[model samples]
Target: MTSTVEVSPAARRSAELEDEITADPSRFRILTGDRPTGPLHLGHYFGTLHNRVRLQRRGVELGLVIADYQVLTDRDVADDLETHVLGLVADYLAAGIDPDEAMIFTHSAVTALNQLMLPFLSLVTVPELQRNPTVKEEIGHSRQAGVSGLMFTYPAHQAADILFCKANLVPVGADQLPHLEVTRLIARRFNDRHGPVFGEPEALLSSAPLLLGTDGTKMSKSRGNAITLGTTAEETARLIRGAKTDAHRHITYEPGTRPEVASLVLLAALCEDRDPGEVAAEVGSGGAAALKARVTEAVNGAFAPLRARRAELAADPGYLRSVLRAGNARATELAEATLAQVREVMGTRY
Candidate 1:
């Protein structure tokens, strides 16, 4: 047994400041959002979502925004919005993003966020949007109606998502740097035109290497390669068993020489705390069958806790609803505060 230590108010404040400084001495809020297009996958887990959980544990204030409205840029169907959003929430929860540590809210929940988009639009130019790499990939020129106004102005919405939360850090991939650059520009423009109310958030580029799907392409739901967090243990095992691997009778972890074996090696390494080289050596000695067996076991073991928690959470729909409701209220409060400042700066204040 150990004695509990009670901190004084001053000491508590100092400790809080120390924790924030430890996260980043510059003390910028972190804002990240995911479009509720589909359930999250392994790529998401190792890439950024894992980092989000780590950040939350490190005492960083996290705002996990569900970009529900952003879905309309490509998808016109409203038939599955509720299902998608709820599924996304389940995925997030399953991925260890505690609602107590992070505020999980949808874009549509905060109505005033839309109001911030217009002024942010004025701050960024057309050339900037055209230069965005993701926009190019997401909305290729070959498509009919090459781009919608919403798609064209997605940077503005991204800006709103960050500045609305007064986020100092935006975790993004290499392809999303341009989006953060635009957000930085908008922050400076707003500060210059109005006042120093917003801090230009910096991008926390993910250190995790891009994990491809089983089909040897991007791990996306559209490609059917994604192993969703909501998937059952049996399902996860089945997917891993059926996953593409090298045709080599024996296993070796040479990414250049054996891409398929290397892929499983990497996955096993990521799921377990073991090193890829070590796992590879083991597989190389034992062969592909042994590698597959260990890989399947590792995947299941890694996902076990999450799957159990998700089932527990799923059983109580009311609890999940309340959590989302609380998150929405907290998000609305923050968004409204930011919007009030925006209105003041834009001279919209009555």
Candidate 2:
């Protein structure tokens, strides 16, 4: 008998939702995107960008946010964000996101979207914000030099980003479920207090496994472990070569014990769209050199097309700016409509 594993409620619900979406995608709207703090990376590509392209191809409406203002949440790490936002658009285009279809805009550019934050904050209690697992985790970071107020109200802002476009489906990772729950609560409370101004959103949990850094920890740009999308082929190989590995000669996909090796293997597998087990077996007995070579080759080959597209996009900065402006205009229209509803429902339209 083939072995079987039990699925969780969230996974089952997500499956049902995907099936419903696949059958009638026109009825659904999706809001998803990235922070423009830095370059896109392999982890980000596998994590959500590819999924956005997949949904977009299926004729789904997408409101992709380049949350530039969110970079201030930390209050300490902000650099060249406007430039980074442009680079981010280039990456999105290179990764097959059609500018004509997806409404990609910076939240800071949308006044009405940010304005919703004040009303949204009223829907939730202080204890609830403090209780949000995701926020609590981020607040834990305040022990160093302390985080900014933006850090505290980030979930509300995130809810605004999602609900502003009246997006019903949000693509999130498992770790983000708690945060999404906060958004769901806000929507529920608002709808109950006022008229039906918003739809309760649900999560589309990514099937992509968490990709750890080369050092066997969370992949981070500041940590210098992330292989950014725009890194040169030579730089990619160098980074992979420096990845943490073990002395064991026979390669195997053991994430629990051999996390470093497993991360590299997973990276290669994602690059080539193969199973991690198969990737490990293919590199069996070849050791770290073989693993590094395979990962480097796979990553470089995968990114080659995107890199060329990005370079082409970079040459036309005016086109990139126009895309942002157009998206901002469209997003502003949607946000204005939503804000009008919010004001009317609250009887604060005077």
Q: Lowest summed-lDDT stretch of 10 residues in model 2? A: 72-81
lDDT of 2 by residue, 1-350 (tens): 89989998888889998998889999889998877777888888888889999999998898899988888764445667778889999989999999998899998899999999998999888888888876788778554476667878888999999999999999887778888898899999999989898888999988877788878789876677898888889999998898889889999999999889999999899889999999999999999999999999999999999888889998999999999999999999999999999999899978
Candidate 2's error at 209, in angstroms?
2.1
TM-score of each candidate structure, all chains considered together: 0.88, 0.95
- Residue-pair clashes per prediction, in order, are 1, 0
Model 2 spans > 4 angstroms off: 1-4, 142-144
State in Å the error of residue 55, model 1.
0.7
Candidate 1's residue-wise lDDT over 1-350, tens digit each?
A: 99999854434544565466586744646788788777788888888789888878777788888888878875543458777777777778888888886898888888887788988888877988877776776677324456777777888888898888788877776566777888899999989998887887866656675566776666887678978877877887777777777667667667777776787888898998888898887777676678878887888889889888877877777777777788889989988999998888778889
Q: In candidate 1, which residue pairs get closer than 3 Å at backbone N, Cα or C atoms, i.e. clash?
A: 29-168
Scored by lDDT, the top model is 2
Error of 1 at 161 (Å): 0.1
Provide the overall lDDT of each model, using Cα atoms, as 2-decimal numbers: 0.78, 0.89
